[model samples]
Structure formats: structure tokens, C-alpha cells
Target: MNIKLWIDKGFEILLDYGPKLIMAFLIWVIGNFVIKLITKGLKSAMKKAKYDISLSKFLSDLLNWSLKILLIIVVLSTVGIETTSFAAILAAAGLAIGLALQGSLGNFAGGVLIMIFKPFKVDDLIEAQGELGIVKEISIFTTKLRGLSNKEIIIPNGSLSNGNIINYNTEGTRRVDLTFGVSYDSDIKETKSILMSVLINHPLVLNDPEPTVNVSELADSSVNFAVRPWCKADDYWTVYFDITENTKIALDKADIEIPYPHQVEIHKQN
Candidate 1:
């Protein structure tokens, strides 16, 4: 009610809280600057270490967020705020969310592991979860794959890491497996010789293993020969197509009878 009383009250308030406010503001500013410096250092280190782009970005973001949250808590504590209550609430909320999103969090953790471990990379042909394709991108939750048929597949990171992952392109060489059938009466040695001629003439097929063309099995209808060849990974499909096309022609030229499924009829049945 009195101007004198109001002025005195204002002075008292400033004396009590001004120092605390200044200190809190200073702490926040210093904390934010420190956070920036640390994040920058992290980015530089990651870059120098030649980390993957997706992993580096995710780590940088994660570090910045963690620093910011820590800065907030430190600033609040400086201002004489009780941070324990907030911390308790945060812990409870985190626990509740973690419980609800257990699978998602597992995937996120799996993604981090995948990024760190470097099982497969973009453009690599990988087989996982019964799906075979070229990896397009690796994200925090899922990995994108471009199938051989050009279909896009999104697979969960958890499943990808937890299950078996076959990286076909990791190595430089691959084996081409082919099976050909011939009539039981056909000359086995001649059939093998013809197939071996086909393999030896193919430019893409490697000769280190000597190109196995041996009698594999004898089915009820036909005898099977296993034709195995080693070649460059990139030439696998090419060699496969060429061998399939050439084998048929070579066998036909050699007059090897490839029998079809047929049944004999008996007139005595009548």
C-alpha cells in the first residue's frame, strides 16, 4: 500500500534472489557452450576414425541430447531447485516407456550394434530373415533392402542382428552350383566329359577347383550330375545363366537323352 514499503520489499527480493539467478544463467550459458564443444570434438573424432555416416550422425545427436539434459539439471540445481523430484519422475517415466517399448528399444540397441559391428553395408547383397537383397540403408529401427526383383524390403534391426546374416558380397569369389539330368542309359563318362568341356571353355569360370562335374545322384527318372564352378562374385549370375544355356545345348549336341516322366501301359490290364 505504501511506496516506501514496496521499494524496500523490492530491494529485499533482489538481494535474496539476484545472485542465484545470475549464477543459474551463467551455469546454463557455460554448460551449453561446453556441450557444443564436446559434441564438436566427438564429431571430429568420429570423422577422423572413419565411422559410418549413419552411426556418426546418430551418436552426435545422442551426445548433444544427453548433454542438454544434463545441462538443464545442472542449471536447475544451481538455482536451488530440487532436482531429485524431477529425476525421480524422469526415472519412472523412462521405466514405464521402456516397459511399453521393449521390442522397439531392443531394435534400437540392435541397430546401434549393427552400426558399430559393421556386418553389412549399403549395396552389399545380404541374406537375412529368409529375404535376400542388396542393402539400401541402415536406420535406427529398420534396414532397407532392394531385392533382386527390385522390390524394397524394410526389415527390423532386431531381427537382422539376432538372426543369421549371410553377406554374399563380403568375399570376392563365389561358387556356382548346377545340376543336370540325363537318361540312365546315357554314357556317364561321356556326359561328364561334355559338361567338363563346357565349363573349361567358359571364360568366367575359374579353374582352381578344377570344375567338378561328377555323377551326383541317380533318380528314378534320370541320373543327375553336379556341376560346380568357382568364379568371381560379380560373375556368379552371369556364369550361372551361361552354364545353364550352354549345358542344354552341349548335352543335346552329344545326343544325351534327358528323359521325361513317363509311364508304361500294359494291354494285359484289359
Candidate 2:
């Protein structure tokens, strides 16, 4: 008798919940498929809008998760769960999560600001947080950089957004400024002429604005000349290094002496 009673109760429960369970399953399947389509469309729209890759990815993920949550709520409600109770639980959980993830939230917000303002983009050489590098990628919370030494650097967007950023590639043309010192024995006019000739003859150097090589300072050991030459931003580094080394070689060929520090001691007779 007891076994029969248990069997009857089980059958009644299954009957009561069977349709609801099936409906919930259907909703889940259809909702998930719809979400996929929506996210795909969102990605396409973002691409058409020319949105930043990092920002677009973040937004898509956010939307997908949010929609899935809503779909789950609807499925639960269909299975006889109370919507009000579910909402209250969600509210409390969200509060707890927000408190626990303050820093991540701040970073996310900063990333949004960066995407909007666009201080730096991928491939731009920038200086921030006392580090200089080319931007490799910008992510939801972190930005990646390729350092001059080829090391990968990851920085939090929160700090990056708050700190000062020096974007070296914003201007199409960059001025390569170099300072070289010649020995005091060298004639200033001849040294200047040599420096100017080096700059003028360089094919990469822009001639429209002209290059300036002038005597900037008279130090104890040497006379310093400031060499300023303008070149396309993409050629700045190449020009910088080439001009510096070439100037030395040119000066050597011209017999101009580059100054270096030396110490002299006179032996006193006892």
C-alpha cells in the first residue's frame, strides 16, 4: 500500500510539471539561438560603424550575457518560479558583485573612455606610466604594448586612462632633435657647416621647412650643436639613429674632434 501511494504521488507531480518543463526547454533553445543571431548582427553593425575592436568585443559580450540572463529569468518564470523573487535575488547579487569588483569596474569604465576619446590607437608609439612602446592591442580592462626591447607589456586601463599619455605618432611629421658636442679646438663655424651639410644631404630630411644646426652651448669640455631635422613620423626613429651616427662619422672625416672627459694630475715634487 505504501509503495503504491508513493508511485501515485510521483505520477501526479510529473503530470503537473511536464508541460512547464518542456516549455522552459523550448524557450531556452529558441532564446539561445536568437541570442547568437543578435550578437552576430551586433558585430556586423559595429564593424560598419567603425568601432574600435576592443570596445566592440566588450560591448558584444556584455550584451550577450545580459540577454542570456533575461532569457534564463523568463525560462524560470515559465517553470513556475516567481519573477519578483528572482529579481530581488539578482539585485542583491549584483550589489555584492559590484562591491567585490570595484577595480575591474573602474578599468572597464576607463576603457570605455579611451574608446571614446581615442588618445592612442594600435601601432601608435606612446609614452605612459614611465614606459614607451608601440601599442599592440587595447582590451576591455588592459592595454598591451610591445616595448622597444620586444617585451610585451600589459597595463591596466584605469591607470593608463588616468595617467599622462604622450602619443608620438599623432603628428604626420616629427622633428628629430640631436645634440652633438665638438672639442673646444674645433672651429664653431666649420662644425656647424658640417652638421648642416649632413642634415641637408640626407634624403629623408624634409627641406621645405629646412634643417637647423646651431651652436647651443659652450661647455667646459666641448661646444654643443643642436641639430633639428624634420622627417615623416614613420621615418623619425630611423632618421634619429642614422643622423646621430652619421654625424659622428662625417665629423671624423672632416677632422673635427668630438670632446670627451679626461682627468689630468700634476705630480708635485716633495
Candidate 3:
């Protein structure tokens, strides 16, 4: 008689919960399919919008997990479990995590802004936050740069996005500003001519804009000529160094003196 009673109880429990269990299982499977479809559609949209690869992947993953969590809550409720409290707990936990990672969150938002706006991109030369470098990689929270000295520099995206950014490659060319000082007695016309020649002879210097040489300052000891040269962005440094070296050589060959301080001593006889 006890065995029969136990068997009846088992059947009663199964009858009570079987449909709910089956419904919850169906919901889970269908929710996952819908979530996948949503994620795939979002990825397609982001791709059409030309979003950064890293940003697209990150956002897709974020959406996937959030949807999975919501689906879990729905399945739990379908299985006769109260989920209002579960959602509330999740909200509270999310709030706590947000508070703890406030700075990181800001950086993540900044990175999203950067990827959307495209202020700079990988391999582009940029100056921001007093650091100049080629953009190496752009991540969700930080930007990596290959510094001029070949050092790797990592900058938090929050600060980088907020700060002033100077993108050198936008115009495809750069002006190299240089100043050369010659002795006060040097002929201004001759000095300008020599400087102009140095610019024209350099292979990297651009000629369309026409390089310029003008007297910028007349100091006590020397006359300063501002020499401006235009070159392809990638050739800026090469042109700058070459012009400087060539100017010195050309000036020396022409017998023009670069002034230097001289100390004269007079012997006193007692």
C-alpha cells in the first residue's frame, strides 16, 4: 500500500510540473535562436555602417550576453519561478559594477565615440595629450601608439578623446618650419638665395607651393631667416634634417660666417 501511495505522489508531481518544464525548455531554445538572429542582424548593420572591427565585435558580444541573461530570466519565470527578485538582484549588481568601474566605463564610451567619429585610425600619425605617435591599435578602453622613438605608448581613451588631437596625415603633407641664423654682416639677398636653393634641391621637398625664405628676426649677433619647406607627410623629418645640414654646408662653401661669441682679453701691465 505504501509503494502505491509513493507512485501516485510521483505521478501527481510530474503532472503538476511537466507542462511548465516543457514550456520553459521551448522558451529557452526559441529565445536563443532569436538572440542569435538579433546579434547577426546587428553585426550586419554595423558592417554596413563601417564601424571599427573591434567595436563591432565588442558591441555584438555585449548584446549577446545581455540578451542571454534576459532569456534566462524569462525561462525561469515560465518554469514557475519568481523572477522579479532575480531581475532586481541583477540590476543591483550591475549598478555596483558600474560604480566600481566608473573610469573604465568612461574610457569605453570614449572609445566608442572615437570609433564612430574616426578622429584617427590605425597607422595615422597623431598628436594628443602631449604625445606624438602613429596609431597602433584602438581598443575598447585605450589607444595604443607607436611613438616616434619606437616606444609603445598606451593612452586611456577617455583622456585622449577629450584632449586636443592634432592629426598630421589629414592633409597628406606637412610644413617643416626651420630658422637659420647668419652673421649680421652677411648679405640678406645672398642668404635668402642660398636658403631657397637648398629647399629646391632637396628630393623630398614639394615645389608646388614654392618654398619660402624670409628674414624673420634681426638679433644683435645674427640675422634669422625663416625657411619654410613643404613635403609629403612621410618625408617631413627627412626634408627637415636634410635642409638643415645642406644649409650649413652651402653657407660655409659661400664663405658666409655664422656668428659666435668672442671673448677678447687685454693684458694689464703694472
TM-score of each candidate structure, all chains considered together: 0.91, 0.81, 0.92
- Top candidate by TM-score: 3
How would you encode candidate 3's per-residue C-alpha lDDT over 92-187 as one tens digit per residue?
999999999999999999999998899998999999999999999999999999998999999999999999999999989999999989998899
Which portions of model 3 show Cα errors greater than 4 Å? 48-50, 264-270
Better of 1 and 2 by lDDT: 2
Superposed Cα deviation of residue 118, candidate 1 (Å): 1.3
- Comparing 1 and 3 on TM-score, the stronger one: 3
Ranking by lDDT: 3, 2, 1
Model 3 TM-score, 2 decimals: 0.92
Model 3 scores worst on lDDT over the 10 consecutive residues at 201-210
- The lDDT, on a scale of 0 to 1, for candidate 2 is 0.92
- For every candidate in turn, the CA RMSD to the true structure comes to 2.1, 3.9, 1.9
Measure candidate 2: CA RMSD.
3.9
* lDDT values, one for every candidate: 0.90, 0.92, 0.94
lDDT by residue for model 2 (28-132), tens: 999999999999999999899766787898899999999999999999999998899888989999999999999999999888888878898999999999999
